[model samples]
Target chain A: MGDVEETVADVGEFALIRRITGGRPKGAATLLGPGDDAAVLAAPDGRVVACTDVLVEGVHFRFDWSPPTQVGSKAAAVNLADIAAMGATPTGLLVGLACPSTTPASVVDELSAGLAAEAARARVGVVGGDMARSDTFVISVTALGSLDGRAPVTRSGAMPGDVVAVAGKLGWSAAGLAVLGRGFRSPVTVVGAHRVPAPPYAAGPSAALAGATSMIDVSDGLLADLAHIAEASTVAIDLVGGLIPVDQRLIEVASALGADARHWVLTGGEDHALAATFPSASSVPPEFRVIGSVTRGAGVTIDGKAYTGDPGWQHWR
Target chain B: MGDVEETVADVGEFALIRRITGGRPKGAATLLGPGDDAAVLAAPDGRVVACTDVLVEGVHFRFDWSPPTQVGSKAAAVNLADIAAMGATPTGLLVGLACPSTTPASVVDELSAGLAAEAARARVGVVGGDMARSDTFVISVTALGSLDGRAPVTRSGAMPGDVVAVAGKLGWSAAGLAVLGRGFRSPVTVVGAHRVPAPPYAAGPSAALAGATSMIDVSDGLLADLAHIAEASTVAIDLVGGLIPVDQRLIEVASALGADARHWVLTGGEDHALAATFPSASSVPPEFRVIGSVTRGAGVTIDGKAYTGDPGWQHWR
Candidate 1:
């Protein structure tokens, strides 16, 4: 938006950062913000929950396919969801961006705008970060959260007979990915879901308050993530096929693509949905839908049957 | 360590991560360790100082010149220094490593070993991380620290007449760099210093307790970093050349290479020494040496004269 054309190399790293953060609003929890060596965020609960995620060009997202802003938002959102999954309230984020010197400054600006927008939506602040030069674009984000004095909801807490429930939509992101992979021209919602996830930010602490026995963010598909809970808790998980809450758009898109909606719902990931186990006699939270139950076994099964289909998303496959 | 000769690609990202972190000793502060979505750390002070740093291949370090261990240690050290600079004690670290699919799992293990060793030295735990495939190797580390309820010592607090002092060795890293650049193989100490910096970690909080007017970690050159303090505090910094306490190794190497040791001492960065300003009349801490004074102007000058040499290291230049 400036009259003059200048590259990120021309402005240098520090100046570029100052320009990007200028006039940006910092939240109340940001005791000391970006200009310093590190940011000080108010914990309020004597504990901090932290997580980090890295997105690489071509490997994670192609610039030509995903806008810089969407990439930025997704990068921050996934990390935030990890903290949320720990039953913590979001507080602040630190971003590490590696891009080629030839990258347009405008792309970086849009990325910042997207990061700021997502942080605001999550009610967190962009506290501090480091920028560096690289061959390909890479954005690594670390999100910090406050536990609010509650015990962290861990995956190993689930016991036999605990009811399993999910707090957000599933299968939509995987369907979105399928549509994007197929280069479908119609169905904007499916494509949007793939580009930028809408993780249920408030549902994590809510589930904790509702007495979640064990929890995890749905990253490596429902079955794969649940397998983590199963392994940690040393219990078997049984999901009811009819209980998976999926979007209609995903069903329609999957049908049109000749792909199984159940496969997408079960093996698809990146939705960042919070799935947890609760006591069978306990009341479920309003935001959660009962989808499964924990049993006295060693692995996860669907409808009391072993799933012999695809495993899940593998990072370096 | 095992009979399996699996590459990172062969094992896949998640599996490789599980392998690397499986038997490591998690620190006391890590209540919830690596398997969870997010790691929870004890923040004792109701506040955390957080920061992230990205080190990219060729831009930040060269694998040929720096061993994988050095790369891992330096990456963790820089991020931990940010926490220390905030007058906080680092508690935990989250690492994100992006590497080519063909990278050996052994290398990943050694890198993790380096990270663990560094975190131990800093009295922090390596909590959790993400691994992904990329064309080049990049390491992104986020460090979390506890402020212990003490008010953060910021760069904007220096006042006129405050004595500018630095704790720990200066120019040793830069001198070590010069030694490595010239292919000097005789002195391992110089090479080791260049590879793994020995920062005075405890001096940061000590400065805060001694009532430091302002504080910063000298990641950039002394003159350039001091300029940041000046800009933040609205004061000019005047360095007294006679007072700088540099290592003798730097002098020997500089003399051998016909380089100016003073220049290295003043402008060579990455030593990660804690630089702070204290009241002129107060007793200087044992770990620190008074090297300059804050004045009523802007920018930094050396003995009443502006520097005419290289400003400092430039990223990707």
Candidate 2:
């Protein structure tokens, strides 16, 4: 923090907002940006995909474990992943931040920078937001996306005999969390994955274009998220244990910590990897790897048999 | 507060969300409602107006003074007013809620009901939301609106010689606040105004259709919000002291509280009243009462003289 950095109370709400949004660049979809009563976003296809996610201090993140920038990035990533899971191209974002009055203004600035950077990577912009005083930090992000005239790929469209595939890394975030829990700072990649997930932003729209039957993001553990799909599509899914790709680093970290790598791969959440069902294995793009198949039953199984284990993440459990 | 009412922890996150959003009616603009990765909203005009606002416990509201339903209504009111201020037709809303695990599930249901009522009043619906556990209650609402092919009425469009007018009640909320501060429980209307504002939702689009030059909602005091228009438009506003409408009920409440009614009328906020400028007095709609006029200077004046007093509500001040 800089010596000259002031607390949020020292700078009034309007001034603080002005400072945060003042010279920020906007994307093509941003017809009108902040400073106005409301932002105007172009929805050329006559439809917009919208989603919101909230992160509370100590629950979703901790300042001691993750930097302000990483917190902001993770917040953006989670919401953007929802849009991606809908097979839409993210257009813009609106953020609502509540924090203590004693918080330094520099922290907010870093968070804003992080949000902008992640939004840019996803080809979107931070167009509007709200800020308020709170006893603890709370970040709520709403992502707006466009389908570009394509039909949305919902989780209910999967059919029997369809191939199940995934894009982006699996279980990295869960592995990273375990690593962090053990106080191991080395293996920067694993530790960083826990702090800020890198979801495959382009795979969603690509899968939609390639005629994916159903899609979802891996926020909860794979089995838990797949259970949602199975319930929604009224189809059972069978995962091939051998086909599940396990990262070498995750294996190393799990072995060192005496943890089962397969548990993390099967039940890890927050990786934001894109999971989809395709009509055939050949229809799955190179970015996605076939790991399972849709069957005509209920729930999920491993190698055509029920393998009982811990389900994915659930809040307030 | 029933014995059978389960805590949020007992119901769990996913079940809580499903119970909140299940089988609710959707508006015409809601192409796809919740229970998916994202919600789809139709913005047939090819553009969407969006804004967000957050209300935190003990900071924006008090549980002792407000029930969960009132809290939800007020949260929805503020964000809907922002969309109305932009001269757009509000079509949908996305809410993000955070509360303690010990909170009863019935409280959330009541809050959701309140939100639904307010959204219905504004001709919109709650399409999606995120809920999480927090130590304090927090509600973040994002309102989405459509212009319907009309140009947005920005705050910087006011020109000299335009007539300034307002369409909703002023100072009633301030008087109500004073009454609340003085610990008075009677005067149901005033107390109700403070808890749930009745913004002039139709007047914004009406004024836009009537060729209003500039517009804003009275979230801050009349003079303070007008100052914003003045600064943005590079013009001054002069109010006619005798022409300003003062509600008799507000005057009575202020007299009982031994507070200056004029101060509240000019500087009190959270009224959510639509104030705009027209090219001429003849062009002003019947719903609006002319209170002032635009002039070629900076700042605001009353009866051609600058009346200095408290500027208005400033968060974190």
Query: Best by DockQ, which number?
Result: 2
Task: Write the residue-wise lDDT of candidate 2 on B1-317 in tens digits.
Answer: 46676899998998877766666669789998988999999999999999999999987888778788887888999999889888898999999999999998888988888888888898777999889999878999999999999888889999999999998889888888888888886698988888888898888888888999999999889999999999999999999999888888888877887788888889989989988999999999888999999999999999998878888998898
lDDT string for model 2 (A90-160, tens) is: 99989999999999988888888888888888878898888899987999999999999999999999999
> Candidate 1, clashing residue pairs?
none
Q: What is the per-residue lDDT of model 1 for residues A193-276, given as tens digits with 9 covering 90 to 100?
A: 777888998999998888888899998999999999999999999999788776777778888999988888888888888889
Q: Pick the candidate with the highest TM-score.
A: 2
Error of 2 at A202 (Å): 0.8
Model 2 docking category: high
Worst 10 residues of 1 chain B by lDDT: B16-25
Interface RMSD per candidate: 1.0, 0.8
